[model samples]
Structures are given as C-alpha cells and as structure tokens.
Target: MKMAGKMDEEIDLGLAEELGVEYEPYKMSDDEVIEALRQINKEVPWEIPVSKELLPYLRPTILCEAHHPEIREEALRIVEGAETSIDAAMMIFYYMISRIKYAMEPPKTSPDALRTRKGNCFTKAGLQIALLRSVGIPGRYSFDKTLLKVIKIVVPREIFEKMPGKFTIHQSADAYHIERRKWIQCDTTFDEGLMPFPYNWNGKTDLLLLCPWWRLGHVGKSPYFPVNELLGRFKQRGFTKDFCAREIDPFTEHLRTLSIQELCKHYKRTLGRRDADSFAHILYFHFVGHFRDVHYNPLFRYDTNLEDLSDLQESGLRIFEPKYSVEKFEEWSVSGIPFEVE
Candidate 1:
C-alpha cells in the first residue's frame, strides 16, 4: 500500500511537471483581493428551503444560524438547572468534550455528529458553536495563527517539515458573555483534568483549554476556527483550501523525488520562497477533505427538498438570529488568490 501510494504520487508529480505546473507568486493588493473574497463568501446561496411552518433547524443557513432544536435541548439539559448563565455555559462546554471523541474532518450537521460520537477539530468547534447559538448565546468562529502551528503534529514530522511551512489557520469557538460584557475563547476540542479549563472568567483573555495535552508543553482542536482576529489570514487560509487542491500536493510529491540541491533550485524558481509563505497559497487539503462532505452530503453540495429539510429543521426554545453576516471577512492578506469559486 505504501509503495503503491508513493508510486501514485510520483505519477501525479510527473504529470504536473509535464504540464508546466509551477508557482508564480505576486504581491496582491490587500483591499482589492479581500473585497473579492468577501463577495464570494457571501454568495453561498441560501433560502428557507422548506415551509416556514416546519422546525427551526430545517431552515437553511443565514450565516451563523447553525442552531438546531436537538443541540439546544441537549445543551440545556446538560447545563441542567444551572443558577447562572456562566455556569450553564461551562457545563455545556464540558458536555461537548466529554461526549465527543476527537477526529480530523470538516464539520457536519449537529445531529450527524451527535449520532456518530466522533469528529475532527472542526466538528468539535461546530458542535460547541451550534450549542451556543441554539441556546441564544452569541458566538463566532475564531481563527488563530500561533495556535494553528500546533496542528503540524497531525501531519507527521517528515511530510510536515517537508512542506514550505505551517500550511494555514486553526480555529475554535468564541462567545460573548453578557454579564462579563466580553468575548471568551471556548477551546472545547480537548478536555483537561482542570480544562485543564483555567480561563479566569475575566472575559478578556482566551484560556488555552488543553495546554498540557497539546504542547507536552502546548498544541491542536474540537475543530473550531478563531474569529476575525486576523482577517487577511482568514482569507489566506480559506484560499489555501483551493490552492493546495490544485497545485501543491503533486508539486510536493515531485520535490520528494529530487536531490537536496535539485530541490533547492526547484524551490526558488517555482515557489519563490523557502518559507510557509512560498506555498502559503496551500494547505494540506486532504487534512480536511477526508471528512468534508461537500461532494457527498446533500446539505452541502445540494439543497435538500422541502420534505427532507423538515426532518432537519430547528425545534428549539429560541431561534438565535445571527449577529454577523456569513459574508463577514478580513484581517489577513492573501495574494495570488483568484476570485473564482468552483
């Protein structure tokens, strides 16, 4: 199997080289590029998709409205009779980690995740956010750079080190605490004996939820992206999803067959840098593809008919309207990203 996979990779690279595949880096004007991405992000078409008479979750997305009746009810049940919202929130976060085993994949609908009892960092983050949004809590995706680097561990040191550098972003949940009057980072991807959950409730600082487990000294998910802390970085990271799928995987494979000096020469001429910035347009697309249901999942690639959506609609106490538009974007600058959406 290993040899076959390696041979497959070699063929892919040979095909790329024969076709004149190579990187051509250029400085993208931040304003023009970001505006284009923001437009694309907003354009993912959505509609009621079902009769307004049915369940809440059944309705299609309008940005952060990922809430569903089951998610809300379960979250409320776990936070069972908490005296304060904070306590309730804490309980819900705990329930997320305790219940879901960690895996690596793009997020799925809350019910699917709950039924399976497993998901990647993205799934974990999505689960937490669904709960938060379901119960009327305000939240958004949080993207962190320094934190994303910890994900390098998942790639295997050999393949990971061979890449230009850290491929892209890491994300988690962020929620607003009303009484505290601030946003808190809810790193639910891991469960520490303590949270090893030491965030001081000040609502300002982000508590690194599983510092010891990840790092040995600190590291990686329940699959959440940080909020717009770095906008350009967000665009940069999202843009990588497409770039690597189209360019890097085979290019990297081709590089594997070359001598050190040949690799360096190829690197400078084709990639333009010896840093993550070189293949900055790329991410290990496979890292997320194994689980992302884009092509297979109806809810993602195709809209469900009115009847099927009825089963998936929201049946909750409250329908938390999204405060932010799905179109919200910015903080990072990504160059060489074409505005094309497939």
Candidate 2:
C-alpha cells in the first residue's frame, strides 16, 4: 500500500536494490525542498508522526539543545589532557571529526555522539559544541546551503541522484579561538575514511568551517540566499522545549532492538502522509543530516572561504587519517543503512 506522501515517481528500484537502501527515487528541485517548509509556516501542526508499533522508539532527539553536565565534564577532561588551549580545542574537534560517521542515526545529545561515534553533522556538532563550551571555547551554529555534490565521496551515485544536486540549507559549527581571538569554522561533517578527501575538507582554509556570528534563523533579504523572507514567519518557536534528551531517552533501548531495514520501513510509512513542509523537516533533521532551509536565516551566515589555517597548526589542527580501513566500500555504505547521499 502506497502511503499519502507518494514516493515521487522517480524512485529507482534497481539502484535501490543494488545500494541495499530502500528509497523511491523521485527527482526534486531546490524549489521543492524550499516549498516543503512553507507548510510548517502556515497552520499545520509541526511534528514527526510515529506509528503505534514504533511509538516506544519514535521519540526525536533535540539537536539544538546544549550543555549536558556529565558529558561536558568528560569532554573537559579530554581537553585538559592536551598541552595548549588551541590544542585542547582541536583535540575536541579531532574527536568529533574522527569519531562520527555521517549516517542516519536519530539526532542525539553531545554525550550520545561521543558514546556512539555515529551520527550526521547535527549530532556531531552537538558533541563539538558541548566539548568546546566545557573548555571555554565559544561556539555557535553556522548554517549554509551546500552542494549535494560535495557529499558524493560518501554517498553512492544512484541514491544521490534522487535528491537535489544542492542542499540550500546545510549546517556545521563555528568555534572561537581563545589565543588568536578569532572564530574558526571547524566543519566536522565528513565521515572517517572520507575525511581527508578534498570533497569533504582540506587541512587549511575555511572550506570546512561551519559557523555563525549571531543567532541564525533571523529574517533578512539576500539576493544570494534565496529564502530570506520566509525565515521569520515560517519556523515555529519553542519547538525545542518539546525535544529534551531525557524525554527521548526512554525510547533508546526500544530503538536499538530494531534492524535498520525495519526502522526505515517504519520511517517511510509513518512519514508518507506528511505534507511537504513536515516531510522536508523529517528528511533533514530526523531522517538524515539537519538540512533545514528556513529562508531568513541565511542572511546571518558568516562569509567564509577556503583560506588555509595551516598557521594555526600550533593550535593542534592537522590532517585526518582513519584508524580503521574498510575492505569493501559497498559494505561500508550498507553497514549504515540510514544515511543521506549528500
């Protein structure tokens, strides 16, 4: 039975079978992704629907909420072990960069990211933020629209084709440098093996720094950033109050019991009836990377370039090398059943 949110006719079955991830490929443009959010602005209730069968494990993790005491202290200890302040910050960054593999794990708290070492950019950044703040390293959200192509290194091509070529709203974290008194954009999104690849990041430049100067999601016009006006009226407020970690913890054990295939089947069916707006939100925040594209927020995006930060190597920044190697690339992708293409 097809659910209300029909898989766009473009779903590629053979490719899905080949990739071992079940998704109906329907080609959508940037506009469609943008429009999906509009439903959120209007009078529709914003929520991720959970089926009765999976209700025990369907609680969503609040990605924006920060500062878990125990987790922060543990991260602080790791930072304290480092020789210098910058070294400490980079140590935190390295742990976050090294630990996570971009995938479809439900958004979890900072402690969860460290404990599990698997999540998309949002959860990974939560760990980074928690660790940085514990050691007095200032950090904030730096959301931007990024090309989906950049993710090709990690995502298989056939699955990648289903999504828009560009994600107009992608995110990473920005951390302040205490000694130099500059905020460095430490984009910690790419996975373990793919970390060093040029598509993911280079040792130098802001190419991978994800950050923001002020509270993002504020409304302002931008010829370059398309969704400026829609930002203010569209995104709901006080939504985070409902996304607490403690509230979600009850569902964790139950969620762990399901196979990835079982979980995805539930996600597809429950979300099938969702209107485009909630659908987009689910696709980004809940299902994969948090790629919400609220229009007004982009104006606050701090401009960054691929400037080399090699001079800051003294800050403990260095190239990434994966400790464990994958024997088969295809196996690596399938092992993590729920992840995005870009």
Per-residue lDDT tens digits for candidate 2, residues 61-93, read 133222345665566566654544455655665
Show the lowest summed lDDT stretch of 10 residues, model 1: 324-333
Give lDDT tens digits, candidate 1, residues 1-342: 111112101112232233222212123233443343344223222111122222222211222223445665575567565554455556666566566755433334455666666544555666776665455444555544343344442233444455444334455676656456566676666322111101122223464432222233212322223222222332333323334335433433344454333433443443233322222111112112211333222111112253332332232211122221111101110111112221
Model 2: ten consecutive residues of lowest lDDT: 293-302
Q: Residue 240 lDDT in model 2?
A: 26
Deviating ranges (above 4 Å) for candidate 1: 1-65, 147-149, 152-164, 192-205, 209-342
